[model samples]
Target: MTALTAEGLVLRGWEPGDAAALVEIYRDPAMLRWTRFPVTTAAEAEVWVANQQEGWAANTRHSFAVLDDERLVGCVALKRGIEVGYWTAAHARGRDVASRAVRALTAWAIGNGVTTLELRHQVDNEASCRVAEKSGFRLRETLPATPPWPLPGHLHLRTG
Candidate 1:
């Protein structure tokens, strides 16, 4: 995928060298609570990065590392041209990193022929809700807790 840049942040394809930073980001307690992926070890992180590369090659998904001034700050991804997800490192919170990344990715996806994008977050996660809304997503429905999602969530949608 092409690298996207805006306001000093760059969203680019994941690289093997990014595994260590992925480990640190994924190990954050907030990340652990929100995502179901197993990323506790460097090996798992390597697998995660590999999966991202494979997904890109298959056209099933696109994952980007969010960088600020060349420092890894988070990630944003679009899956199956429908679902969108993102996370910001603890130090990057409160700076609108997630919202900016989401907006950038959303625009890129729509420009590439995707008609809509969706995001779902646990109902209690006000921060996520804000990010989705700030990035132009509207709450569309409520989904009950399921196997992967451990809590009720608000499903948000953005249509091009």
Candidate 2:
């Protein structure tokens, strides 16, 4: 994987050493509250990152670590069918870190053969919606909770 630089943040492949810091980001209540998946332990985060690496190794998913200066701050990823997920440090939100990261990642994804990207946010998550809007995704529609995604959310799509 290649490291991406945009708007003062570094986006790169996951590193084993980034797990602890990733755990810290995931443990923040505000950050966790909106996430589709719940994460409660550092070890879990480590395992998650390890799994992310394995996915990267096999070319099934593309996960990138987001860094500010030298600190691991968050992540942005592309799953099957151009589905995307991203989270920024509680301290990093509202600073355009996500917008920049998304823009860079989207450019990379399209260049790599993804024709469209999809994202979702819970009904009440205006912050997340803002990120998607800022990143150029259009609101698709509200849908019933898909079998595995416990919560109901608004789906958005961006095609380029």
Number of the top-ranking candidate, with TM-score as the measure: 1
Candidate 1 runs further than 4 Å off: none
Tens digits of per-residue lDDT for model 2, 1-160: 7889978989999987887777678778987776666666777777888888988888888889998898877788888748888888887876888888888899888888888899887777787889899999999999777755566888989988
Clashes of 2: 0
Candidate 2: worst-modelled 10 consecutive residues by lDDT: 31-40
- Compared with the true structure, what per-residue lDDT tens digits does model 1 show for residues 55-133? 9999998999999988899999998878998989988999999999999999998999889889999999999999999
TM-score, cand. 1 vs. native: 0.96
> Candidate 2 — what's its lDDT?
0.83
Give lDDT: candidate 2, residue 7.
Answer: 86
